[model samples]
Target: MSSPPAHPALSCAGLAFAWPDGTPVLDGLNLAVGPGRTGLVGRNGSGKSTLLKLLAGELAPTAGTVRAAGGVGHLPQDAALDTRLRVDEALGVAGTRAALHAIESGDVREEHFAAVGDDWDVEERARATLDRLGLDRIGLDRTTGEVSGGECVLLRLAALLLARPAVLLLDEPTNNLDRHARRRLYAAVDAWPGVLVVASHDRELLERVDRVAELRGGELTWYGGPYSAYEEAVAAEQEAAERTVRAAGSDVRRQRRELAEAQARLAKRRRYGEKQAANKVVPPIVAGGLKRAAQVSAGRHRAVHAERLDRARERLEEAVEAVRDDDAIRVELPHTAVPPGRDVLLLRDLELRHGARIDGEFEVRGPERIALVGRNGSGKSTLLRTIAGEVEPRAGEAAARVPLRFLPQRLDVLDDGLTVVENVARFAPGATPNRVRARLARFLFRGAEADRPAGTLSGGERFRATLAALLLAEPAPQLLMLDEPTNNLDAASVRSLVQALEGYEGALLVAGHDVPFLEAIGITRTLDMDALTSPRGAT
Candidate 1:
């Protein structure tokens, strides 16, 4: 495709990039954006983050040019803020506000006037940005350490918004955010006036984008109007592609049948010609001429049918190529099944070590899916840890009636030196190697991937590996719990996780703020950490 005319916002041309290890992340990618929000989406390791970094000039591309009309503000996935820094300093306005304050006081100086700049409204804008991001309560004088992790993310975004750059890039902006904070981020996205691109697996945030740019196989595909529309379009395209594949297969079969019939007819003709010549019903020369002409005609007939068959086969191949193979795993977890009347878990008067306390009785019976939701500091992970026997509750009892497993968000269960297969085997000692490998394959770990050491796995890969190991554990984990499961996952990984959970008959207690994910995995009920427990929020 030809490049578009110059844009005032952000654009890239003939972009190519590779990692330090010579692993090609992107090649010949071209993109153009002007004054509208774009959601950049892809599976983990598909270079969505790499592309954003390249566009922001944080990483130089191997091949092409990136153009920004003005400055670019980037909020990286792990954009770290100093814990000791004040909110105004984090927002990059402390000096200016200080100078403004100096001028207002008795000690006015020329440097103060210079530092104030022409815009005296900086303080007002900074406060408004914070207010917009639902951080007004945090106070500008407060240190970053005083805020929760989710609030810190919003503060970073607030800083970016305060800068008022011409282009903004957000990578996983909603990673650890709760439902309220996510909505606040969504509002910020909605009100952004400049060119914006967000790389995140958060469906709700992606739903607010004006367009979606999907990076797959080292190329960018533009889909107009948000993630849901893109998904619908892809679904329709896959359906049409499958229909074409079926039609093409039928055509190939029909062409093969016709070619066989033609060859059979030619054989009969040859036999008839030979028999007639032997019987001497006609002159020898005429008989030979008849045979030659019949042979020539038969060769032409065969050629026509053969060509048709070839064309049909080519069409079939093309149709098959068009259809996507988004195959997810399917494995029956019968060993993990809990009978309808079985008691899975029970917690009474739970008081966690971090000053969080849970009152009243809580229980899980049979195979129930429960969603855990709350602000970042809410003790959801602590509750799960107590239930998993990793931590003792300060007050009451947390016990499981069945064999259980807990997969934490940090994913520290695997032994780094062991391969994925080895780790799973360690858990399921009774299972044969072949059975373990077969089950691992269903989790999308196959061949060399299953053989790779757990230490080298990416966040999403490690999550899958840990989940697989836990599921294949001894006694098969009739009760499974996960803390903030969607924090570091990409879209495909999230889908794979959801699908993997679909076949399990075990009781699930998943802690996270991804409402759509909870809904997708068929949650039987929701447990709000704020309502279920009380803790001194993150300092």
Candidate 2:
């Protein structure tokens, strides 16, 4: 297919901003976004959300300006509707409020009517948009207060789509949504004919965009394709940079060696001159010439040493660049020598319920790396929790071999007020402070970081802290149950976690949507919770 046309819908020219405390966020940043889907990526605290706010006109830049041609619709990170309003009421207010204001201003002319396109019919259009977003089955008169967080997000998305603004900006839109809801959101954006900009850390969502823009070191680098293509290009660049650094280092080393050899020869000649002077057998003129020659040789050695040092410094910088560009932080998990029994886990007629009806039932046996596959609200998490003894089954029963550890999806078991050392010590009481700190270091929480409170740590750090605590326990659990372990981890961290899991000999029950992660960890079996609930032989 031909490349999409670059019809600039949003432009930032020489943008600069800083906080009240004089902390610089964006400096001399420039960006242009065209119509169609574009992905915005950045690490935590990289100003992705700030840029989005600037584009949406929600924040004023300290310098320069942002220009957009038409109305901008922004999906805020936390969008909550009033509990008093029904779904239909919320949509109606969002879609027609602008037109209502214009009419109240007594500016309702033929042009205004034409611009709004029959404001009286906006409710019908709003309903249609909501239906397209899979909200049609829901009652419009239903209060938003009764809906779930995921549902509230969907309703807000539907409201934005119904407005049909010229530009749409979404910031971490899928952070709280389920897999099925996320897929639906992606479909809605794909079908929209307007300009779309999404800021997210979700690789799967980024892969659906037409292009990927990464914010690093206060600058944006645009890649012409999706996440996969961007990753390949970055990897190649890193490899080439590494090669250059290696060559430069080799040259520096050779120069240093030559300098050292010249110094050695000059030293030997100086000693011979001293011996001649001691014997009083050399002429004055010849002695002076020899001294001058030694001085010149020493100067040459000094100059060579300076040059080599400079070159080595430059090469070291190049190596640092290569390392920074490559996300390769490897985390090695300390595996315990625990042998699981033959019956790792057994679930007989495992039935669970959300309301009155049974959601699922199944039988699972030992040595089976079975995946619980189902859409959101299909009771996948419930099944895992039931197996972990966190939830009671409405019917049937579950049995597991001794020693089990459950990593809940929320990571709520971690005490936020305590330091990493304290948390690990709690889990492993006999472990000394030094041992706890050492274990935390393995997970990249080194030095003073190990003393930082868990509440202050980032999402990735919190997850690592939890994992470190689990591993340090005296007798490790043979059956490990993880609920969406990869949700908040970065790409590099996720790879490290997968590597650790691959080496694990214990039975694992993981509930996640990352297909590559599941494959990497060697999931050998598959079970559909939704299928389990259905009548036998329904498939």
Candidate 3:
């Protein structure tokens, strides 16, 4: 035997949790994570984040127990930092560092010695951790406010690493990170010596994981390999499920045919008996006895065939349950197409209100799909807003010849008080309710889901509704601009977005940091603000 299986680094038994408002999220779920990187994946609101929270002890379970072999460290989705806290304090070594400094200055207090106990090189270790995460330029004395959001995320991860916890849980750690910062985090995940569970939709990051744990429908499932392996496994499972359904369907048909044949035979026998009795070939008493016997036999034969049919139907139902029926977004915008080589937008030496300047002229012709990429605070959103006419340029002129729409990062296009259909109606005022609902169904909001208030939808649902509102607008949007469209979306929503955009024939300008999403959308060119403003030190 292979030396008895090692104990799980993290374990949870009968893990149940419900909100104070009585909405159950995890219902008596159980999971165990061994040492290595495990990417946790699921649809939005499927409790991937919630289970991480529970495992980290950030939220107490409504029932059951969670146990960690050693210490547990968590990096939440928001990664909040105290702006006034210094880097040393953020790294949780300020106290020991101060004590060591005091001792070096010849203060021999017992408390100082106690605080600096065995680890005399805390600052050096902290610096090494920071350097590994690409924060070598940052000074330990500097305040948190001095760093960008992406750097802050790295800083928080650095703190967790410096602690050397046995178990680490990170939730959507790459949400606001740029490509460079993401690579640094990926390196850390690669070198982790203990259990690391990350809940994310980032395919690149997930590919580095040793395994995958999927949380869905209040239950947990373990896949033995990375994201691609999980995808393959699920695909194989679905194929087999479909095959079972086909076989079950065939069995049901065969059973039904057999029942029909049995009934036909019974009818023929009855006709023969009636003819015999009518022709007076047998005694009346004998005919009555034979008729009763035949009736009893027919009832038993029908019951047996019906029971077999019912069993076959039950098998079919089980097979159907095993097959997933996820719907895809299918919106069509034929009117949004632009003629070849037509000028859709023109920017002439414009200086954006947010301090990013386009010194040279920029033109978007026909249906060119351009990606605006840059580090945070480099004015990507400002450029999109200026193009959308939401912000006035500080200098030159920006013009749009075709109808355009802008979907901000906040997804503020919809009215919170209105239903999804009503929100679509806001953009397409001339369309009837039936027509609006018909279009909404393409966005996967069929039937009563179209009646849900915009404010009550989940993150993914809200994004879909906002997209529907913009795409369904009157005159169609030929020049569509989106700011960080995949910021908080789940994997399914991101796939849906790509599918929707694939069918769009309009000129597109999207400003975001998701490289995978940009590639999936088939971007024809990329505009790097850092390169454009390198002479002015914008980077």
lDDT by residue (320-401, candidate 1, tens digit) is 9888764454434545778887898887777876566667677788999988778866778778888998988889888899
lDDT of 1 at 277: 94
* Candidate 1 pairs with clashing backbones: none
- Per-residue accuracy of model 3 over 348-429 as CA lDDT, tens digit each: 8888765677776788899899998887556777788888888788898889999998988657778888888999999989
Give the per-residue lDDT of model 2 (tens digit) for 180-273: 7788888887787988999877877888898888888898888878888888877887787778888777877877787788778878878988
Name the weakest run of 10 consecutive residues (lDDT summed) in model 3: 530-539
Residue 261: error of model 3 in Å?
0.5
TM-score of each: 0.80, 0.73, 0.81
Displacement of residue 486 (Cα, Å) in model 2 is 2.5
lDDT for model 2 comes to 0.73
Clashing pairs in 3: none
Best candidate, TM-score-wise? Answer: 3
Q: What is the lDDT of candidate 3?
A: 0.83
lDDT (Cα, 0-100) at 57 in candidate 3:
91
Better of 1 and 3 by lDDT: 3
lDDT, model 2, position 414:
76
